[model samples]
Target: MIKTKTLFTKLFLSYSMIIFLSFTLFGLVFIYIFHLNLYDDYEELYDFHYERLQEQIAQSAEEGWSDEETADLIQPSLHHRNYNIFIYDNTGELFIQPEGDAEYEPDQEIILTASDEFVSEGATMNGNLSYIIADSFSVPGNEETYVAVMVFHDLNHQYQQMALMVLIPFIITIAFSGGIIYFISQKITAPLRHMNEAALQLATGDFSRRVTVSSRDEIGQLGDTFNYMAEELNSLEKMRKEFIANVSHDLRSPLTSMKGFIVALLDGTIPENKRDHYYLLMKEETERVIQLVNDTLDMSRLEAGQIEIAPAPYNLTRQLQRIAVLLEPQLERKGVGIQLEPEDTDLFVVADKDRIEQALVNLLHNALQFSLNGETIRIQLETTGDMLAVHVQDEGKGIPEAQLKHIWERFYKGEKSRTGKGGTGIGLSIVKSIMELHKTEITVKSKLGQGTVFTFQLPLKK
Candidate 1:
């Protein structure tokens, strides 16, 4: 199998071929037009000379000069660089021969009785292609006594000279054009080549590689997009490594605690009275482990599109009130009051009720964990146009501005100390995924040391 050519090579070859063919065609046309023009000028020259010779013959005949005088009179006018002149009498005899040694004998019968005023024909003489022109003139003294002049013009030398003159410039033009075209093609494809190299590096797990943009054209835009993708992949690679480390740490901590508690109870390290307490501690650690595993599985399923949303009409306000009542014990323990500020009208929305409830639980739990004692957690529902917006506001230490953007990413915890606050760091990610499944977006507005508000909109049932 033959290997294919590179893009640069193909472009250069195609451009060069086009230039070469164009120059070849133009040269052919130029040569053809030059040939025609040369012939026209040659015929005109012969006609002019023939007319001058006739005037000279009329003058000689009017003055009654002899044949020798007439020949001398017309000789100067008959001389030409590219043509040989012969004059024939009415009796088909040569009257004036050319001044130099002739290569072939002139045809007297053809020259004298030629019918046309200007007759041009091709003849082979002395192994070369030659052009012959014949014209007749009547002497002023006698109308019947006429003289016919034949001009033999050799064309092989002129054609050879013209070919040489046209071919040299044509070759030079093709060479110059090919060089310029190659340079331009290289400039055009340079970005694509860099992008190809960067893509290869990325495929090999080197996400740091990037392409340099040199133009504002489509190829440059492609290079920019490639660089952006590489940056994203690099960020994702870092996140993946961090995720693995976080998972390992979270898993190991719970397993190690449970292992220690079990060993202490089994080996009599703890007093008999404390065994029950240690067992309870082990059970709590095991529960934490189970929660982590469940959250991880939920996130995986959501991201893999394995979870389907079943939407239906449900009362938005009643759902929030119910979640608050259910979490009344936890909220009471923390001294955090639940405030439900819903619209007075029965606000119904079309969404997956179970998924929305899960999202609300996550957000409410997050608020409860962060709220200070005696602070109020507000669950507000407001109607805006055809959408019903829900807001979960916590009067707790707010998230920093820098960490706000990454709050919805899996395993991204803004407060490291909140790891023990009953969260697997997958709650917000789950909520975000659920909201996205409903074709809506979750938004957060927070400032450090103030409070955080989590808002999402749902379509109101018409």
Candidate 2:
């Protein structure tokens, strides 16, 4: 992958090149178009006078004027018009080169007609490119008289100066626009650089790192999303660390107790009269360890999508009653009562029987765990439209509003300390996964002082 600094450089240089190219192309096209549109007027004016001069020479010959008189008639006008006039006689000899030292020549010569115009490209005395426009007309005695005009490229030279005049602004505009593009590129790459830094921190297990976001554009939204992801990862990391500590305590305490009990039994420190009680205590500790491992494995499997649910019709109300019976011992120990609301009715629902059973066991266990003595946990059933809804509501110490949302996350027991209780922490997550596999959702409604009602619905069998 390319470094962010290199990426910024690429963006800056690419934008600068585009702006530079655009200005260069625009300047060139503007000058070329202006040159073509304004080019021909000077040449046309010179050709007009050459033809008129031909007519004047013809009239002078008819009236029998002398060469000196003819020269006196048109000499000043010819110099003012910047023309080098020529006259060719019948034999095609060098007839008259007026303005005697005019070092100019037309590359070709031709006879004249009413609409005849001849233009030849030639060079001036200083070797600069020039144009010669020539015309000939008939005079007295069947003489062939031609007039040639030489005009240097001073117009094109003026166009060159004009191009230079426009070029200064173009260079200045390109430089200014390049600066603006660099600023915009900085704005674009700054957020990405921050995100890259945060990502590196994240890779190093620093989930607390976050990017600053301010704009409302797509980049801003990306920054916002990155920060949100970091928050969630921080939360999950916290949960993971807590879970590890809890699991460690849970395993170590049980194993330590079991080991102590075994050592006592092996050494006969536990009297024969109390050996049975010690054995039972050890067995209970072993069961706790087994339960913790099983719950952890179940959560992993569910999250990995390794557990597939098979939906079939089952009596949901009867299942709830069975769960109540199975948890009767815990209820009795807590002096709690399990009551089923409208228990006489049968509700058939489409769900995986084993998965639903697993889910009900967890919910009832949780409800009983938080419950106080003489508190009744109500298992309510009803047909809501096309589905049968089962609500396991508990009269225990209700969960706080803040922790209610995270109840279904793995190892997220809001109160954290579950001393003297049997909870593997991922029970609610397993239940939620089971419900989701049945194409349904488990929802909770609770207040801090009031109670919590866990509700889940399954499709009713028709």
Candidate 3:
């Protein structure tokens, strides 16, 4: 597998490269434009000087002045400026050459090619690189013409300054852009970094760690989700510990009872005539242990999606009546009566009949555990729209409002004091899992000191 760069490095490099390329292209274009403008100004300045000299020569030619007098009129200005001025007659012969150690020879072909417009060409003058601008002009009131050629040495200095003007600001802007991009990238990734750390802590079983939500953007929403997940994991961890402790206690209590009874019988502590009574008690304890193990296994299979439900059309009323009959022994033992209220017509529901019956048994068992003697537990079935609603309501001391939401959780017993209520504490969880598998929901409405109702809806057979 190939290693990749960190998010911070990637973000910084990506943003920085974008800014750098943009500024660099802008700088190249800016320098090109600036250089063109400078070149235009230099051309205009040289053109003005060339025109002045042409006007002087024309005026002098109209007056019929000698070449020496014309040089005297133009030489002073030529010396003041940084150019080597050369003048030629119409025949392409050298007319005037500026006083310098530089040697020159004027070419007739070059002079004839020159026009009123300035033409620039490279040349070597006095052993240095030089640029020459040449043009031709006609004398006023005279048919004679002359060509003017001006040579400038080292003209690149102005272009160098123009490049510097473009480059300096570009460098400064790029540096400033780099700083801003780094800050922005950090601001964007800071929340993610915190979430990464929180994730690591969570992986290490630190469910209590939560991320800080600093903004109301997507990252902030992610942080909120992460915190919510951590809270759920923390709750689940607590419930897992409680489940293990409960299971151990439930297993050990029955084994300890069975052990004591067996030992008493084996050592003849109880008389042979009374052995039958102790044998029954030991059998009940063994059954209790078996019941706990079966409930635990069933819950695990249900949660692991291992239980395959066979859905078929079944009479809802008959299923409820059968469950009530099955639990009648315990109900009668507690002096509790079950009231069945089915709809007038036979209510057929499409569901896994066995699983639905199991769910009803769990719900009724829970109600029985909380109900008082002679209190009637109502099993009501009603039709709402196209769905059938089954409610198992108990007239027991109702569950507290705070604990109502947690009752469906595995191993969540509402009353810790009633720990020996003949349950594995996972009955309601199994009920909830069954209902969910049927693509429905179960709801409970309870008021403290009032009655509690556990209602679930199932689809009618199509």
Specify the highest-TM-score model's number.
2
Query: For model 2, how does the per-residue alpha-carbon lDDT over 1-462 read when each residue is reduced to its tens digit?
Result: 655457788998888888878888887888887765544655676667666776677777888888778767766555533445555544454445557535654433442321165554444545554545555455556446554554444544666677887788888887898889889988898999999999999999999899999798999999999999999899888888878888998899999999999899899899999999888888878987987898899889999999998888988888878888877766887899988988899888888999899888888888877878888889888888997788899886688777888888887867443224534468899998988888888899987656789998889998
2 versus 3: better lDDT goes to: 3
lDDT of 3 at 322: 76
Q: For each candidate, what is the lDDT?
A: 0.81, 0.76, 0.81
Record all residue pairs in model 2 with backbone atoms less than 3 Å apart, i.e. clashing: none
The number of residue pairs in model 3 that clash at the backbone is 0
The TM-score that candidate 1 achieves is 0.80
Query: How would the candidate models be sorted by TM-score, starting from the highest?
Result: 2, 3, 1
Between which residue pairs do clashes occur in model 3? none
The model with the greater lDDT, 1 or 2, is 1
- How do the predictions measure up, each by TM-score? 0.80, 0.83, 0.82
Global CA lDDT of candidate 3, please?
0.81
lDDT of 1: 0.81
